[model samples]
Target: MAAPVPPPTEPDASARICPGDQIGPCAACHRPTHKYGRGARSPLCEYCDAKAVERLGRKLRAD
Candidate 1:
């Protein structure tokens, strides 16, 4: 009988780090992202991050 095949492995987390730009995954969408401005520690991609901020602003204004 033939042996079963092993499952494919995911790349190491370190491998996903962009070497030249030091970019990594977005915190919200998990897409690759890079630092933009003063909020360097944020891992969110621009669109999701903007949406998050907008949602917060709406909540604050509603209160």
Candidate 2:
């Protein structure tokens, strides 16, 4: 048997505005950054993402 085809869908507005590899601000901090894949208007920069992970670890430990 063959697999059924998936239905088409409209493209996201953000994806149209900011395609993959486009520079955008970090979600946590207002810092210009890239490397966020497609339509990421507010993606976290490396530093912030690392800090968030650290914070999460601490929070988990405290609990």
Candidate 3:
């Protein structure tokens, strides 16, 4: 027997983000990361995740 498909539901979930064709912000820098590629789970497309990590280190060192 074939499996039944679930109908589409309304999008009201706060965490349910659906980027039609745009990339999300970087988790670390919180900057726009669309120039690189389509994504939003950290490790922005424009730059590497390490870049942000380094910046964090610098900030912590200052304090």
Top of the candidates by TM-score: 2
lDDT for each residue of candidate 2 in 1-63, tens digit (9 for 90 to 100)? 944422223222333455456756657665555634666465655556567778786454323
Evaluate model 2: give its lDDT: 0.52
Could you tell me the C-alpha RMSD of candidate 2 in Å?
12.7
Per-model TM values vs. the true structure: 0.45, 0.47, 0.29
Model 3 Cα lDDT, one tens digit per residue, 1-63: 944422222221221443535545545444544423453355342233445556675454323
Give the CA lDDT, 0 to 100, for residue 16 in model 1: 54
Q: Compared to the true structure, candidate 2 yields what TM-score?
A: 0.47
| Clash number for each model | 0, 0, 0
Cα RMSDs, all models: 11.9, 12.7, 13.4
- Which portions of model 3 miss their true places by more than 4 Å? 1-20, 35-40, 45-63
lDDT of each: 0.51, 0.52, 0.40
Tell me the spans in candidate 2 whose CA falls farther than 4 Å from its real position: 1-21, 58-63
Candidate 1 per-residue lDDT, tens place, 1-63, comes to: 944422223322342564636565566665566654344564655555567777786454323
- Best-to-worst ranking by TM-score: 2, 1, 3
